[model samples]
Target: MKEIQAVKSSLNAVFAIKDLGQLHFSLGLEIAKTKKGIHVCQRKYALEILADAGMAGAKPVSTPMVKKNEKLFEQVVMHDVSAYRRIIGRLLYLVNTRPDISFIVKCLSQFVQAPTKQHHQAAQGILRYIKSSPAQGIFDPKDTDIQIKAFSDSDWASCILTRRSITGFCIFLGESLISWKTKKQNTVSRSSFEAEYRALAATCCEVQWVTFLLEDLDISVHHININCFKVP
Candidate 1:
C-alpha cells in the first residue's frame, strides 16, 4: 500500500492525476475483489452486446456451436455484412473472459470476409450462449500453489474447406486460467498423430513465451506442466 501511494505521489507531482483508491472497473472489464480472490468479468459489456444484436430476450443455449455435421459455412451470403462483422468484433473482445466460446469464435471469424446467413445465425448462437452466463468470468483464487500448467488438443482436418486442423489450448496459473487460444493451423496434417503433435508444439511455444513473461515480471515459475491428449 505504501509503495503504491509513493508511486502515485511521484506521478502526481509531474502530472495531474487523481488516485483512485482501488480499481473496480476499467476498459469494459468489471473487477471485483472478494475474500476468495479477484473476480474479473464484462457482464455489462455482454448485456449491451445482446441488446445491440436484438437478442436480449433470446433463449440461451448450452453450447456455442452446433455439432460437426451441421454446416456453418454455407454458400448463402448475408446481406448485412457490417452487422455480422460488428458482433464478431465484440465477441472477440469478450473472449478475454469467456474461453468456452473461443473455438466457435475462431471458426466464425474465418467467414467475416463473405459471411453467410448460416454464419450470422452461428454468431447469434454465440450471443444466446453468452446470455446464459453473462456474469461468468475468471476467478483468481487467493490460495494458490503458484505453479503453471497447460492443456492442449487438436481436431484433424476439422475445416471442411481447407482441411486444416484446429489447435486449442489453455494455460493456468495455479487453479486459475490466465491465457487460452483457438486457431486453425496453416497447413493440413496427414494423420491425427501429426495434428496432435502440432498442437503440443504450439502449446510448448506458448508455455515458453509465458515463462519469459513471468521472468520479466520478476515472478519465478518453479514448476511448469504441459499436458496433451493421446491419440488412440
Candidate 2:
C-alpha cells in the first residue's frame, strides 16, 4: 500500500491525481470481482482474435487437435516463416486463457522458425481448434482449495518431421489449472518408457517450482499427485 500511495502521491504532487480504489479493468483482460470470487475473461480479445482469424462464425469444437491430422512434409514446405510465427504468437497469448489449446499450440510452435507447407497445415488445425473455444479461460474462485496436482503424458516418436516424441502435462490447484505444457523431447528415446519418463521429469521440475511459489504464499501444496501416464 505504501508503494502505491507513494507513487500516487508523487504523481498528485505534479498533476492533481484522484485516488481510485480497486481496479475493475486493465490491459486486455476483463476484471470482475464478486462475492463468490473473481472472473477473468478476454471476451473482447477472443472475439477480436476470432475475427482476425476469419473464424468469427466458427462453431465450437470438443477437441482442438487430432493425432491423425498431424502430418509431415510429403512435398511442399509452407516457406512462410513470418506467417507461422505470427499465428503461433497469437496462439501463445490465447493460451493465457485457453488451457485446452496449450498442448496443440506447443506442438505447432516447434516449426515456427522454418515452417514447411506441412507445418502451416498443422498450424491451421490449431487455429481451427481455437475457433471452437473462443470463450474459454482460467477460472479461479475464492472457495477453492490449494491441492496442487499434475498429470504427465507422453507420445513416443509422435513427430514425423524430427522423429521426436511429444510430451504433455498439466498441473492443477484444487480443481483449477495453474500450469501446463506440451513439448517435444530433445533426445530420441529407445523405447516408450524412456520418452514417458523424461516427460515425467520435466513435469516434476515444473511441479517443484510451482510448489515453491505456493509456499511463498504460505500455502502447502501436496506432491502426492505427481503421477505419469503414457499414451501410445
Candidate 3:
C-alpha cells in the first residue's frame, strides 16, 4: 500500500490522478474478483457480437468450427465486403479474453478481403459457439508461481488455398495464459519439421516481446522454458 501511495504521489505531481478502486469493467473486458483469482470475460461484448451478426436467437453449439463442413477459401463470393470486415474486426477484439476461438478466427480473417457466403456462414457458426458459454474466460490465480513458459505448434499445410501452414503458440505466466496467436506462416515450408521450426521462431518473438513488457512493469522472470508440440 505504501508503494502504491508513493507512485500515486509522484504521478499527482505532474498530472491529475483518480483512483477507481478495484476494476470491474474497462474497454469491454469484465473483471471479477473471487477467492480463487481474477476472472476476466467479455460477456456483454460477446452478446453484442451475436446481436450484430443477427444470431441472438440462434442455438448454441459446442464447437467453434464444424470439422466436416469447414469453409476453406470457397469460390462463392460475398458482395458485402464491409460487413465481412466489420464482423471479423469485432471477433478479433473478442479474442482478447477468448483464446478458444483464436484459431478459427484466424482462419476466417484470411478471407476478409474476399469473403464468400460460406465464409460468412462459418463466422456465424463461431457466434453460435460463443453463445454456448459467453461468460467463459481466463482465470489468473493470485499469489501463484510466476514462471514463464511457452508452447508452439504448426499444422502442415493447413490452408488449402495457399498450401501454407498455420502456426500457433500460447504463453503462460505460471497457470495463467497471457498471450497466444494463430497465424499463417509467412513463407511456405517444405516439411513438417520446417513448419514446426517456423512456429517456434514466431513463438520466440512473442516471448521476447512479453518479457520486455514484464520488465517494464518491474516483474522479472528468472527462468523461461519453451516446448514444441505437434498440432493434432
The lDDT leader among the candidates is: 1
Per-model lDDT: 0.91, 0.76, 0.90
Better of 1 and 3 by TM-score: 1
Candidate 2 colliding pairs: 77-117, 78-116, 78-117
Off by over 4 Å in 1: none
Taking every candidate in turn, the Cα RMSD to the unseen true structure, in Å, is 1.2, 3.3, 2.1
- Per-model TM against the reference: 0.96, 0.80, 0.91
**Tens digit of per-residue lDDT, candidate 3, span 1-232:** 9998999999999999999998999999999998889999999999998888789999999999978354556687887788778889999999999999999898889788888988888888999999999999999998777788999999988777788998999999988999999989999998999999999999999999999999999998988999999634
What 10-residue stretch in candidate 3 is worst by lDDT? Answer: 66-75
lDDT of 1 at 226: 94
The best candidate by TM-score is 1
Which candidate, 1 or 2, has the higher TM-score?
1
Model 1, position 68, has a per-residue lDDT of 63
Q: Which candidate do you rate higher for lDDT, 1 or 2?
A: 1
What does candidate 1's lDDT look like per residue over 1-232, in tens digits? 8997899889999999976778999999999999999999999999999999999999999898767634676787888799999999999999998888888888889889999888888899999999999999999999998789999999999888889999989999999898898899888999999999999999999999999999998999879999999886
The lowest-lDDT stretch of 10 consecutive residues in candidate 1 is 65-74
